[model samples]
Every structure is written in C-alpha cells, then in structure tokens.
Target: MKVINTKIADVKIIEPSVFGDERGFFMETWNQKNFELLVSGKPTLFVQDNHSKSKKGILRGLHYQTKSTQGKLVRVIVGEVFDVAIDMREKSATFGQWVGVYLSANNKRQLWVPEGFAHGFYVTSDEAEFVYKCTDFYDPDSEISILWDDPSINIKWPLIGDPILSKKDENAIYLSDAPKLSL
Candidate 1:
C-alpha cells in the first residue's frame, strides 16, 4: 500500500498495490500491521463497517459524533464520488480546514479520516456504493452535522446543480455554530 498525505496531516490517501492478470485483479484492502505502521504505530481496530449507496447529486455529510468520534477508512466500490474531510480538532493547526478527493471504483483509492474530523461525499456518477471501516461504534444521539455549504469552511463541492440533501443535513448548522472536537 502507498500513503499520500493530504493538506491535513492526519488525513491520508491510500493506494493499495493491485495485481492483475488476464482473469481479473486482486488487492489487499487491509492489513492491520501495515495500516498501523502508516498511522498511529499502535493497534488500530475498526469496530464497525458500513456501506451506503447513493444516486448522483446526493450529498451525505459533514458529520461526526461528539462522543464516539470515529476514525474512518473510506472508499468507493461501484462508481465515483468526491469525498471530503474537515479537521474539527480545535487545537490542530489545520482546524476548520478541509481536503477533497475523487474516489472511484476504477481508481480504487481509499481515504483515511482520523477521529475529530467531519466527513462527507458527493456522488459524481450515476450511482455510487460507498463503504468504510470505522474505529468506533455509531452513536446516533451524539452525531452532529455541519452544513455542507457552511461559509466558514467554504467547501468547494464539484456540483452541476444543487445537491440532494437529507433533512438532517439540510438543517445542519455552520461550523461557526456547530460543536467542535476538543481533541
């Protein structure tokens, strides 16, 4: 696997080594030892795995849990999407800043969003299947959503029209008003 650093040091873009032949292709998606070496250099356990599918124009986040605070390793499995991560750690140098990347089944790239960051994505294809491994269990009551188009963060979403947002996301508060991670 190869790791590429994003503007926010805690976030990373991972490219796994793919081996292909006339038949098809194979890539080791995860290996605890290898992943640990790349990140914290300590045991990192993914306690949960999640998968979601969305149609084009669907925008699903800028969300994080104030309590469970998950660190995620996410990727696209069926189509393409522009994934984003915002640093919500109050004391970090890159606090309130964000990074965006195009993740597609064709590219097979994955992104690492550490704890204390808000994550979201915009579908760029007809449809997309997104999946991720999270270090913590979901805590719906603790989940906080920040406005996808919050002016303070000013995320440059690659959109052709207004995105289709869930009611929760539509009503999300701006970064200035949202609760941030104290870490």
Candidate 2:
C-alpha cells in the first residue's frame, strides 16, 4: 500500500497494491499493520462500518462529531465520487483548508480523513456505492454539519448542477457560525 499526503497535514490518499489478470483484479482494502507502517503519526483503529448508495448529483455530509469524533477510511465500491475533507481544528495551521480526491472502483483509492475534519462527497457517476470504516460510534447529539459551500471553506465541487442534499445538509451552518472541533 502507498500513502499519499494531502494539503491537509493528517489527511491521506491510500493506494493499495493491485494484482490483475484478463479476468479481474484484487487488492486488500485494509490491513491494520500495513496502514500503521504506511501512515505517519499515531495508529488508527476503526470500530464501525457504514455504507451508502447515491445517484449522480447527490451530495452528503460536511459532517463531524463534537464528541467521540470519527476518523474515516473511505472508498468507492461501485462507481465514482469526488470526496472532500475539510480541516476544522481551530489551532491547526491548515484549519479551514480542504482537499478533494477522486475515488472509484477502477482506481481503487481510499481516503483517510482523521478526526477534526468534516467530510462530504459528490457522486460523479450514475450511481456510487460508498463505504467507510469509522474509528468512533455515531452520536446523534454530537453531530454537526458545516455547509458544503461555505464561503470560508470554498469547496470547488466537480458537478455543475444544484446538488441534491438531505434536509440536514441543506440546513447546515456555515463554517464561521459552526462549532469548531478540538484535535
């Protein structure tokens, strides 16, 4: 596996080694020891797994938890998506900065979004099956949604049309007005 750094210090793009033939291809999506060796700093432990399917133009997230924040390792299983992560840690140098990655079944790239970041993705293909492992359990009361297009964060989404958002996402607060995360 290869770990690539993103503009944000702790965010990473992980490329796994793949073996292919005329018929198909295979790669190990996650291995605790391998990840620890490839990524810098402290080790990560994923406790919960979640998956979602979205059609083209659908957008979800820009979400983070105030307590028991989650660090996610996300990848696309069926189609393509433009995944983004924003650094929300107030004391960090890259706070408010964001990075985007293209993830698809064909490319087999995974994004590592640590705690103190809000994550969201736009489906670029007809349909996308996305899955992720989280370090922490979900906490409804601790959830916070930062608006996807907050001027302060200024995420440049790939899709042109109005994105389909959940009621929670559509009503998300701007970064300036949102609660900050502590790393």
Candidate 3:
C-alpha cells in the first residue's frame, strides 16, 4: 500500500498494490498493521463498514458526527466520484479548508478522512458503488451536515448541472454557522 498526503495533514490517499494476470486481479484492501502505520502509528480499529450506491449528479455529504466522530477509509468500487474532505478541527492550521480526490474502480484508490472532518462525494459516472470503513459507530442524532456549496469552504464540485441533494443536505447550514469540532 502507498499513502499520499493531501493538503490537510490528516487526510490521505491510499493506493494498494494490485497483482493481475490474464485471469483477473487480486489485492489486499486492508491490513491492520499497515493501516496503523499509515495513520497514527497506533491501533486504528474500524468498527463499522458501509456501502452506498448513487446515480450521477447525486451529492451526499459534508457530514460529520459531533459525538461519535468517525474516521473513514473510503473508495469507489464500481464507478467514479469526486470525493471531498473538509478539515473541521477548530485548532488546526487547515481548519475550514477542504481537499478533493478522484476515486474510481479503475484507479482503486482509497481516501483516509480522519476524525474531525466532514466528508462527501459527487458521482462522476452513470452510477457508483461507494464503500468505506469507519472508526466509530453511526450516531444519527449526533450527525451534522454542512451545506455542500457553502461559500466559506467553496468546494469546487465537478458537476454537469446542479447536484441532486438529499433534503438534509439541501437544508444544511454553512461552515460559519455549523458546529465545529475541536482537536
């Protein structure tokens, strides 16, 4: 596995070694020891795994949990997406800043969104199957959604038209008014 640093110190792009032949291909998606080294040099335990499918133009986040804040390792398994992570840690140098990465089945890249950041993605293909491992359990009541197009964070979403947002996301507040996480 290879780890690439994003502008925010805590975000990372991971490329796993893939071995292929005439038949097909094989790659280890996760190994506790290796992942720990890539993150914080401590045990990084993922307590939950999630999978979601979305059609093109579907934008699903800028979400974080104020209580059970989750650190996620996400990837695209079927199509492609422009994944984003925003640093919400109040004391960090990159607070309120964001980074976007293109993740696709062909590239097989995974992004590490550390705790204290809001994450979301935009589908860039006809459809996409997204998967992720999370460090904490989901706490719906504690989840907070920030506006996908919040000007303060100014995310450059690659869009063909206005994004299709969920009702929660459509009503999300901007970073300036949203609750922040402290490091």
Model number with the top lDDT = 1
Model 1 residue 62 lDDT score: 82
Name the runs in model 3 displaced over 4 angstroms.
none
| Clash pairs (backbone) in predicted model 3 | none
At residue 180, give the lDDT of candidate 2: 83
lDDT of 1 by residue, 74-183 (tens): 99999999999999998889999999999999999999998999999999999999999999999999999999998888899999899999999999988998787898
lDDT of 2: 0.92
Go through the candidates in order and give each one's C-alpha lDDT: 0.94, 0.92, 0.94
How do the candidates rank by lDDT, highest first? 1, 3, 2
* After superposition, candidate 2 runs with Cα above 4 Å error: none
> How would you encode candidate 3's per-residue C-alpha lDDT over 18-136 as one tens digit per residue?
99999999999999988898764668889999999999999999899999999999999999999999998988999999999999999999999989999999999999999999999
Q: Determine which window of 10 residues in candidate 3 has minimal summed lDDT.
A: 36-45
RMSD of candidate 3 to the true fold?
0.8
